[model samples]
Target: MASALSEATSFVPDEATVDRFYEISGGNPLLLRALLEDCAAAQDRETDVLDPCVGGLPGSALTHAVTTCLNRSGQLAVTVAEGLAVLGEAPDSALLARLCGLARFSAMQGLRVLRAAGVVTDLGFRHPVVRTVVLENMVPERRRELHRVAARLCYLEGAESSQIAPHLAAAARVDDPWGVGVLRDAAEEALVEDRDLLAIDYLELAHAFCVDPRQRADIRIRSAVVRQRNDPFAAQRAADELLGMLRAGQLTPAQSLATADVFSGCRRIDGVNEALAALRGPGDGAPDGPAGRAAAVIEYCPPWPGFAPGTRNPALEWEGRSAQRGEEGGTAAEELLRRTVLTDSTLATVGNAVRCLVYTGRPAAARHWVDVFVREAERRGADGWYAMFAGIRAELALMTGDLPAAERYAREGLERLPKQKLGTLAGGLVATQVLALTRMGEYEAGARLFEQPVPEDLFTSEHGLTYLCARGCYNLVTNRLSSALNDFLAIGRRVRDWGIDQPQWIPWRGEAAEALLRLGETTEAEQLLSEQLSLLPAGHERVRGVTLRLFSQTVEVRRRPALLVRAVALLQSAGDRLQLAQALGELAESYCWLGEDGRAWAALSRARGLAEECGAEHLREALLLHQGPIRSEGARADGSYEDQLARAVAQEVVSNQWDGGWRATLSNSEKRVAALAAGGHTNRDISSQLHITVSTVEQHLTRIYRKLRIRGRDQLPVDLQFCDGPTTSTPCRTLP
Candidate 1:
């Protein structure tokens, strides 16, 4: 049977044999023996080697290739082999020394034996495989010692820390001194991948093995950051452990600072504030040497839940006076700037500290730091962080009310986002666009974009409720009343569910109430508006003032003079231009409704001025549209004209069935003219009705067409389409 198998193999290797060769090479001793027997049998013949790729190379061939590379580099010597003796993977020179220093020479010698026997060989003549095999056999402590050594050597060789970290980590696991450093490098790489889970593992390893409390603190802080999103409370717990070390004098100030930052990042506002307080506690000995400067401002990283400038935080203040350090002129900004200056030129630290600068309302300082981050990101070919910083700058512009600049910056930032991050950040970009468009009075376009669905994940952020609320307001502005109401109701439920009755001056909530009022739901609208108004913080006087202005608009139609006067008076006190314009527009309509034409015109002119001041072209347009009701020549001066006008407005309202106020203005004669007009009738055709001459009919028709602003009678179709009710096409009957 052996003879038959040998003859069957012949001198040529077949495709079928490739798997057996790889398997034997992979660690099958029986398969290796069989393959060797076949190779010996075919040695004398001109063999057709079946090796087509790495997959096809035989065990013998791989052994020869690895040995040849090592031989050619003259790295098959005892010195090189001894260095790789204890590793299961590539070991830098330092790892070899550490193993030797630890009296683990026997483990290292095993690798040398494999090298000599050609059982293990160098990858790129570096003896990588030999080292890996030897190290695999060592105890965890010895392996960790070797890994610590290798990490240092790799760092000296300018190798990528992330690329070399795994091997070093094994060495560190065996009580290696350099484990902490290796873990730091690995955790950083994992963070870049957003693989916080892996990062936390490495950090814990560093914490357990690192002798230096400061180093342990550094790793623990990063681990806490990794855990923050998945389990915020746990992350805070981990950070608190580090803080305890600092308080016990077991950690340095720099380490304590890092731990405090992790707390802030997790939004553990109370914990961060408490840590800061302890850091600045009485006789908390100052940090020694260069770290002392950081000690003076250890409490200045700005506690979480930062306010936009000029905003009050009564609840936060009441919670604790000392913890309320995010108030105006807080040292957080200054200390952050100082640390930012101390940051190394590395992309990592520069990017890290600058992020705080932006968050602390020091964007200009951040701008300088961003320049450094941009250069490094470009060198690394990573656009993600660069684009994020650009977006931050755009937000700063928005806060300053530099709308044109904000738009430009936001657009440019969108262009810089990498494709991988597009889904995550796209919603914010779309929101920025919507804000710009709304500010520019492009309501229709904004409404269309707002209707686009947002990702469910985005709803978990701080801005989630605000984004949903904005969608409601956008719908309201574009006349999508039912949709607006639905969005408003949804927002109400979510906010109530979250127990968040007091959102900041988002304005969307107020706008939602206004929409309800516009839809003629006065009672419900008043209640909602009152709820929002009640929550308006003391510092947000502008918003509260605006809410009062909105209150004056209620019942303006029924009690025009009284409501109009209140609206105007509210505008006179601490007027926001946008609010003033809205009030004046309402006041003008009230005057017109009460037949006080002179007062109405004057009020309209005042509204136009404020609209111009506020750059609100849409409000200006609304005021112009309302002018039709007052100046319409078709509206007769006769007593019977009143009933006719009311009936016509009612029919127009019913026809549209969407706009109640519009229906109220449509007169009977107007509806008559509209039905005939929609029936494709001429002015003369409509003229014959109601016993009027064609000349008078023509004159009245001209007035009718102008009042509705139709180009001609044909375009002014009756909304109901027929005298009886709505018809699919023109009615077969003439106007009565």
Candidate 2:
């Protein structure tokens, strides 16, 4: 049959080409013959007609052949074929007949002819290409009306919502309530299956066709909420409609809840209170339901609402109600965290969870939950949710002293949600970024972000408290003491006014005290540190560690080492290497002031190592300033590099023996310099058959300071050997 068609078109087809005939035509010999002849006559020889990906039955010859074959087979078969194309696969015979405007028995006879031609099996196309050809050949208006007919027939026959959605999606709206209801139900089901994009498509279709104004508004609200799962900003297209419906109280209980979710996801704090009102208006139930969940979130809303909560922060009462509010809300937030993760975890749920953990200073727990939120948000493409969670992860890293991780997560989060779209909630991200940069000694980078305008309401949000603290810390480090003090005081006042007492997480008082100490206001610094200490619980080692270290600065020199020792232990137990390094540095100073040379060197050595491990270049430089302090009282504090080397030589001459190890980090030539600078003998040989070369001590000392200064003074492991001059042929003033 293929050969005959090929001959007619003046082309010879091989056996392999005949195989393509079976594949595309589904073994229908008549269809195959026509397709083969069409292929031979085609102008584009490079186009493979057999492969649907390259080309298939969408042109004039294939359409005419299909029409001719169906017409000769009988018009009844053509009717059934068209109906099957509209109704999709395996539709009921009665449904197909009704969609085609034909009787059932007549449609069945047409279906039989289609089966005999191998054009259909089980009342659907024998091949996808066959269906594609028929569907493409269909007239546009006819195809649309048939889809409407198919949808109506499915509805009349009591088909499932899932079964009806596809037809409704393809058909034009006829103002049918049943169609709207099916689309809505199918959209809900699609959400449960995690097909968020599909859910949005269905809701959009339902909204377009819904006749009732309120129904259409409600559909729009649902759509905006669903859209948040992919991109929160995308949902803002209908912001006016959604917010207007919300303000007018036209939404039902369920729609109101969805509206609340949309508002929260978009960072519209102004709308949160109104949504909360609608949620609690008449249908609110137990505190664990949707209303309660939202209430728990609103309870800690930054710029925390007045006494009753969710009132949008107009609180001037300034009562000492912080302790009470913190206890109640902390319990509520912790209780509700696990119940609302992932699918049930809205923006409110995730925010409340992280805030609660931070309130208690449980960084490990906070990191675990934020990680959970991040993975699920990324997988679902929920940009706003992922951004917030990622920022929270960065904040946790900051608290726990993983400075590098803190910087990485914060930069990534800011990238995920650009600062322009970040709104007031961007406070957390900016805070994390600035603080991480401040600690890493990148002041210029941190300053650039400060010039970028953030939302004015940041100072009023809970996130603003953190941002203020970060800014103040930057000020303190950079020597702007007054500005640093003011920022810290602002945080202190807001945290108290807003009724959130989280000494462990909010270290404003400790930070302010440090700034005061630097300004020589010793009395004020000690008072603030004491107040923080009196209020802080013993269980919070992280904040206590930081507070203890800062407080040590104001104490007498004799008492400072004890306080610093405790700070070091506290920070070490809390697993905050960054804070631990700071505490160790302070302790080393205390040991120096007490004239304990050995103890001071040990503390300085450990502190330098910790600073290096934390990648704190600022801390390491600070450690270098302490080398003179840890020396003996008679040792030259203002020693030049050469003078310091002279002292080391004097120690070697008086002792006549030395056994401190040089680390393996030194090169062979550098080791020779160290031994030569030591002892100053006329001649000497240590373990490696190397004689001392004591020329130019200053030159050798310079390299030594740069490399091993951070590891403490003149100390090496048991790796390098040292020998001394002897009066009895020990090479002192006598060459060996």
Candidate 3:
């Protein structure tokens, strides 16, 4: 896997460029090679690869191969292959039969023929490149028809509705009642899978088909909830439309309350307040029901700003000194949970209940609720809900520093994810895996995850915070300080810009402060830590401990050794051994600076033990450095302790400089072009391979020559290997 990735990315110079390649190729090795070959062809001066032949064009060689293969296989095979391409790289034989409107035996025969022709792999197409070529060659109308057939087949096979959703979306128009019902089901399934964008798309499709006013209003409300993270304005528009329906008497009191529930889940605080006011109006026909009371509780005592309204704490306004207020709020929230469990244990209600408990700092209660929800979902055979609940469990485990548990839960959740190209649940599970591995100090394992193509939506507001945090930590551990700082700073900016200033939810400020401190900007680090400390609610002992440890690192070691000790105590209380080990190492250094040899040795010993136990290589190395003769009296006689520390810092800076310089020498794209050129691919061939203009390929070659300090292609070394094969490295053989 590493060799394949390195060959594909050899021309790419940086992490960002590698990420781009992954995004383009979707981590398929064959597709990556095809792109590289096209790039090589484009860069060749002698080859005249036409612009129209690039990418998945109709007359491209790859496309021609696919066309020839299908032509030889007969019409039934051609139809089956086209359906599979539209559905994606792979489709089950049964599902393909349904989509192709063929008998099961005939469909299997067609598949066998395609496989024998080397056009199909067991999983799907022989390569995604072939799939793309086939799909792009089809007429738009034909493609839409295939999608429609695929959607109906998936629905009939009892596949998860999310699997059917994109097909429906691609079909463009669904005016029939059965189509509308399918869309509605797909929307609900999308929501459970956390594919909010897909949910919104399905709901809109359903709305276009529906004639009933109340049903349309319901779809509009649901759309608002799904759109909140990516399109707040759209959510607000949906809210407005629902309000219009309410005033026009198109919705019943119960329906209005349900709409309010949706509004609350979407975090539209103003919408929730308005809905509650309508319910309280004289002769408004608002039923005094559980939904209405829930809305009233949310209106009266809103959650902390940026807290999703779906997870509104019934006890938030009552948790202070007023016992009576606490009881009323707590009772209301608990009653809602009870009713939801007994009467309507819908996925949405169970999810909201779990979030409420978690945000309220009640993990034990939250865990219990989650267990029940998972069991209920299983009983109902709701795989989507089961995956979502399991993901939440993984997140909770991560928060509590249970690395093994988090990994287990995340893996289990991922198993239930639908085989869709873009799924929010899959993104969350991948993020969870990244977080668990990185936090556990497994940097190499975490780095390998970048080999997989990250879904574009993973970078959107819905999952951005988690993605940034994990990436930042990975960068930090890998000694990419500047990159790490950028990621952390982005998190800070995102929170402020979004008006979601709930630090306790993500605690990005603390991570940023750590980065700032490492960069030697102590004043900025101090300010960030101060703000973070202030924002931390009382009783958040674990986060407070983590924040204080970072804070101590920003100040003079001699002046606040006590702060490190206090942080150690707090971390111990929080049961975060990994962090506690880091804190001990910092405390040991502080003690060493203060001329306390005995305390320093004791601290180092404990830290080393914990680091070894947790397999924290970075922390263990630091501990080893401190435990060396540098801490002895003999070292003091040889040189001042300050001088030794300065030398170590200088060494780190010099190492970083060398690494950064090499990384900046050539962009990843230049490297790819250079490898292809050196491997004897013509400029035109490189362009065709990479799907870029020939001029672009030439420009990349020029940049590569300048960066590598080479005068011309002949100057390239004999051993300058391209990833295609080891034997291809002799540039002399490719030269005229």
Candidate 4:
């Protein structure tokens, strides 16, 4: 059939080709192709049409070429053109129609022709740039003229916003009041449809045409949020702009509160502090109806209505009280910080503030606020707000070490959010699940959550931060030091970008810094930590604790006891038992070196107890693996890896000299197996210990043979090398 079509067309080349197709049949593919088929028949050759500009018709012969050779050739020429047109140009149906017209063809017919030519596809306008152009191309007058018609058609056809944006925007541009109103309504419907990158697109468009300042602020805030996940720098820039608006008093107190939300997403401490400054700025001092009420929801009304926390800043508390009563506090403190909390806008800032506080480690305060906000949201039957607050509650639970509760709340939040509207919230919900699973020792499941394609416009300093945490944790547990360092560096970049000054991230920063220290980048690590400590207040316990740990480790390795003592003191005050244990173990080792057995035993005992209490198996294992500090009942001994090797040579034991055998005695694996043997680690633990198959461990032991070795893992001594020790070159046997 294709050959018959090919035999009915003619070829044309050069300058006349561009004009030929159009001149033949008004550039109509069906009509021009008909003419070309006639031309091909006259030449008595298979219809073969060649025209540089196909317009509506390339020719009957070319059709056969496409249908037979070109289509099967895997050539990208036609596919590329279609991608450029459909993905590159047509965002909306109206724009599609206009593009068809510009190409001098009917919209439907043009699509059919492209489809026949295998040049265009129907991706349904998920591509943003395509949609942008399509909507923008419809002249304002025409768009307004057609918006209502297009909307009705779309509604009847069950079409989506992706199918309706260009029409609505066109209607909005044409000043068709009904079209504009319907477009606004459609925008809201579209916005609520998903929690994805696409959701941002629709919301942003709606915000652009929205005259309602409050709604626009809401959309802008959402846009900032989506942007923060994809490009933190851009997110910061947008957040700063919103802060600027708030600071300039251009936005209402309510708007300022919403704008502050955009800043909350800012990972940088600088951005957070900047937003905090704006949120607490001078304009916040005065009363302004519902807006004032909204502002007070976050600031003044501590945990509940008309009640404030005792820990609240006295001046701020006093100001909050005065504002709630509609009476000025009559002081500069009051004037600098004041806003009322009323029923109208109570849900917006109140819940978000609680979330922020929890994340920053003000758990007690966050709990105080969350209790009030959750109750209020439920009482009002605001399901959306309920879901939002519920999610925040779940996050707060995670922060407080209530893993089960966090999982339950996260599940409940996911279920509550409308199924159809799961876009970015879905991503957020999934991320939460990853955190839970990772903490529960399910690394693979957790890694799956990060598999989503990162959109170009989606900004996330937080995602990067969280990713660094997860990746680093995995590497740390698995002993993949190099991979762990990469994750740490990634986290450092995010931290540097986010400018997070709070102590919440200090532990991760410390871990990364420690990893750098291990990688022999001590100078760089010290400088980094020094810079970190400079920003933190001395009163901050976590920062001080981490600083001390790093200090103790770095200095003590150089045998500096004074620095170690200072580090131990700092860690002790922070209740960091695990770190304290490790630090004390190091001190005990030093004591052994100095032949102070009694002091070493006391420190070692204290370290063991602390490690057990903190569930620090790794640290405990470290202490037990080194024989030097062992003060068993009345026995005290000091030995090093070097001393062990020396003893092995003296014994002439064949098992002693093998590198693997040496490792079996003092290696971390052997230490683990020993600890687990004392605790009854099955064959599984033994396998886990050597990071090898249980069969392999058994084989090594069997090779020791009956006369030379002990039986079973239980009979293995702490210092027994499985293979033979090294033999020296003897002077007595040195005859020529």
Candidate 5:
């Protein structure tokens, strides 16, 4: 590398710079030599050194190098290289000879010459970019002809259709029965491997060349189904293109039914409804065969649920309707649902089923179906399906009060689906994560949720009700009372306007009542709590316990103990350790208000135990705040500020034995902490590594900062050294 750099540039590079060039240039000799040549020709070379950052090189440099090398290999080798680039498969000499119209021995000779030129190997091009460069340098007409010939050669060689597909797809919509078959098989292979774009491209290519109307419609339907598993925005574009074809009478009756199912899968309610209606025609509301089964599928998928006046939690309402429809949805819809479940369930079909099980008060059944769905999704390796269903699993965990598990699953789902591709699934999954964090008293982590950017349409979706409610709870706990109240109030407005009032989605009234009560709006608090109680269905002791706990606060003091007693019984039975801990704390507060000292301590003690078990530091902290205002360490009527400062200084001066100024003044623990902070360990990392709480780490840092005269961790002296510390059990001497 150094020799190459010395030969190409006026300046010579050192050993370290040569090693860096080799490493970043990615082990490709052609690419590396090209980089050195490009760096030599750069206009900035007057000021720059011989060492080149590969990213700074001209992209055309590699292409030009490969082109010059091919020319030096002579005409036969150049033709062989072009054919190989067009094929992009294994370097089969026979196939190369056939595609390039050369004799087999001549092709072998050319390949040998090319390999010796370092443009290729006995296997293929040294790098994928080299292959791409060969194609890039070729004219469009020549490239197209090579693709056509390559497709024919591969087919005649008895290759699999999938192996022959790229050439046909690249041949610019050639009309061949065999090529269409190859593209179709290629599309299926791509879909299996989750190469959605390639699959869609292959299907579209086949569709363009297909002459039969039925086959063309079949391709369009397949494209729509695959699109449902992709970006919702891209799916919209595909749907729009299909809609034009539908209106043009390009689709048969059965084709329309299939298209309607695809639309339903996309959560496109209006599009599904319209397409099915067109299939039914004027008086055929209940047509048999394809049309009836299609309409039944639509009916089975709960559309935007309509709420009767005074209906508060319509998701439960829809859940009941969903059950009734499954039983009486006639033979067609029942067969589709059963068929989908038993054989091959699509996301839309299984998602609706899981939705029913999750929100309809069946935790065990919900867990079972979620596990089954997740296993199926994983087995198929469909990231989008796994993400969506895994999010549902997280929601189920949240509902069951498994706070840690809920956050874990939600995080996994988010990791699988990038935020840009999340679509409507974002709100519910994000809401689940925030709510679990809030419930576990992870307020700082919960607060970080709001800092992330979301889709502009996120707040307008149906799941926005749940997302806003989760944010409102975080706001409520963090003392943003007015913002919390506004969040809940907006949910209420959405309930009336959009008619989606699912308590499982968001108990907005209950959340608003807490915010209002905190803000001292008593009347509205009482009314909202009352409405929340009425809205909840029977048998959800968990949701009921939550509402009753809040309601206990709204009543008179004498009546409070009785309401709280009922809440404790209900929450204890419900087995939500987090909520039960919170209820116990609230009951303890009520006891204190009533001057029942013995009972107050008992309840507070139990609450604290539960809070610690659940890792709910905020709840434990709340107990502390209830006693009185927390004071600073030196705060008292004992002395003035200066007098206390002098006393503290005198104690520090007498305590220290070393002569290193402020460094000597630190306690052994404080010294260990300062050294770790100087080593760039974050507060959480320091706390974990040192076997201490984050709060204690913070306190140590505060005292260390005051003693060392440092403004922040970054300002600490880099020379400050300490062991991972003899007392610490951590094996590492420094933070990883």
Candidate 6:
């Protein structure tokens, strides 16, 4: 059939175009030939009939073909074809019945007649071109009327709001009360599904038709709230429109409070405060209501710094209040926030309450709130709220060192984000995922996320802090020290400038100190750590545990052995196994340096076990190097200590050989240097042997010691003799 069509046109279509033709013609040879003849006839004098654009076939050819096909069927069939064309090629039998005001059986017969005539396929109009041709010939008013019918049909069929919205949008008289009401309902449904932009469109259409001033104001407010996630400029316009309504006294007191809530949630702090003040004015009497009390709580105790010009400075006030009221005041506020979470609170109120609970060191309660919100959102099918709550849970899990839970929550949250309309909420989920992967030692995966471009608007929101911190940590692990230092420092500067230096939220100072330490700036590292330590409240045990661990790393191992001990205890108490493993490893090294072999062995064993359990590969490798071989007297029966040591070295050799373990620990260059040094070669001799400078040899040896956790050349492992030997006379035996 394709060959006959090709012969008729004297030109062969590309594979894709041929496939498209087959799809449109439903493999009917006559239809295929007709389409080819049309293409051939429409070709310009110099144009190929099967050129990339299919020789620019005119719409008239399609119109003629569709008209001819429809003429072969009864009027009922023609009407069903038009209905399918109006619905754009996929109208079901029931929708056809609804559109044509016929019985379902009659609609099915009509479809069968059209199908037999080759004007319709199992899917709908045999081809999209056929539908376009039929619709193009439709009169303007008749097309609008058909669209209105289609919208009603979709609504009655329980189609998705996104699916029904476009039909209503295309109706000619969208201001009709029925259309407006449907639009409003569709908008609310879209919002619940997190189709915020879709919701905004429906609300705008409904607002245009709304006759009542209060209803119009309500639509404008709803549009602004949905627009807050995306389209900030549009949101601001809607907010301004609502503010105009407020000034004109068109909005009820409840509506005014709702507007203020929207403004505050969107970070329009000045507008929210203005509305709240108006509601609280002496003659207003609105201040005695529940809305007024909620507004008062926000005004009196803002959770974070406001992002508006001329807004009250809450940071200083919060600091003074913290000092005066202390933990008791925090507990009272937490209880109040908890009660709010249990009530019918807005998204803004719930989010602020969760943040306050976390900030007050009550994560268990925060988790409770998050779980409750997630259940409610799922029950209501509010995908946006579910994503937001899951993101919060991810961040909470990451803070408490629950890497698996953090990754799980982050992935689930990210999947819920609207593909085309991700905002700061999505950014927060990405940050949480990256942080979790990095902490779990999946640096390559985390680095891939770092390479992806972040959204421009994300930096303007609070989630920006999470992104910067995650990026900094990724850089630190990938050995990009300068970049890591700059990012962490930028976070500090931003926190100070914004007057929202909540260390528990970002912990930028502790991160920057680690970067500084890696850069070999010991003095600056100590200063940063000391500053962070002083700022942290003495009772925030989890953060304090982290700060103490960083502090222990800054000073000499022997000078702060006790600090490492304290850090290990705190981390264990907090159940941060990853950091606890790190602290225990450091403590083992200190114990070895202090000549406490038994204590060193115990600490190293515990560290190795924890590292293995947590999948901390780097820590496991380091601990393996620090741990000396275990002695077993039964191996030789009459064994002296030397025989036991020899047995241990043999066991180590077998283990290393099995896993390629020794090679995994040292780089090729370090291996070469260690082998030569173990063969009793001087640094200069090894440098000469390896054709490198003496300083390079020394550097390699230094790295080998660090990798193997040995103090000097004399303590080099017997396995070094097996790495790349020079047939040295020095025996591969235990040191006496």
For each candidate, the alpha-carbon lDDT, in order, equals: 0.50, 0.65, 0.62, 0.47, 0.66, 0.66
Clash count per candidate: 23, 4, 31, 45, 0, 0
Output the TM-score of candidate 2.
0.65
Residues 454-504 of candidate 3: C-alpha lDDT, one tens digit per residue: 655344333556678878888887878888888988876665544445555
Highest TM-score scorer:
2
Stronger candidate by lDDT (2 vs 5): 5
Encode model 2's per-residue lDDT on 1-736: one tens digit a residue: 5665466555566677666566556676666666655665563676544432233456645555566666677768877888898777745787788888888889899898988877787778756656666677678888888888788888888888887887887775654768888999999888788787888888888888787877898788778767666555466556547768877767765666566555555545345445556665443322235654454434433334322243322211221232335445445555666777566335665675575666554566677778878998888776766777877888777766777888899888777764456455465688888998888888999899887776665665556777898899899999999999889888877666544545654667788888888899887886777567655543456677788788778767876765566566667656778898888778778877888765666666677888777767888899879977667343333334223333443443332211222334345666665544332322223322344343433444566656654232234211122322111112111101
Candidate 3 residue spans exceeding 4 A from truth? 1-209, 217-368, 454-462, 608-625, 629-736
> What is candidate 5's local distance difference test score?
0.66
Tens digit of per-residue lDDT, candidate 1, span 680-727:
556676676545566766675676656555456434432223332222
Worst lDDT 10-window in candidate 1: 727-736
Cα-based RMSD of candidate 3: 28.6
User: How close is every model to the real structure, measured as TM-score?
Assistant: 0.44, 0.65, 0.48, 0.40, 0.59, 0.56
Q: Over the stretch 229-311, how does candidate 4's per-residue lDDT look in tens digits?
A: 22334445566667666666667655655564454433222333344344343434333454344334335322121111212
**Which scores greater on lDDT, model 2 or model 4?**
2
The residue-by-residue lDDT of candidate 6 on 307-333, one tens digit each, is: 222334343355346533436545655
Q: Model 5, 267-382: lDDT tens per residue?
A: 54345545655665455554667775653454444433222233222233444454334323223333443556422226676676665555445567667777877787677655
For model 5, where is the 10-residue window of minimal lDDT?
727-736
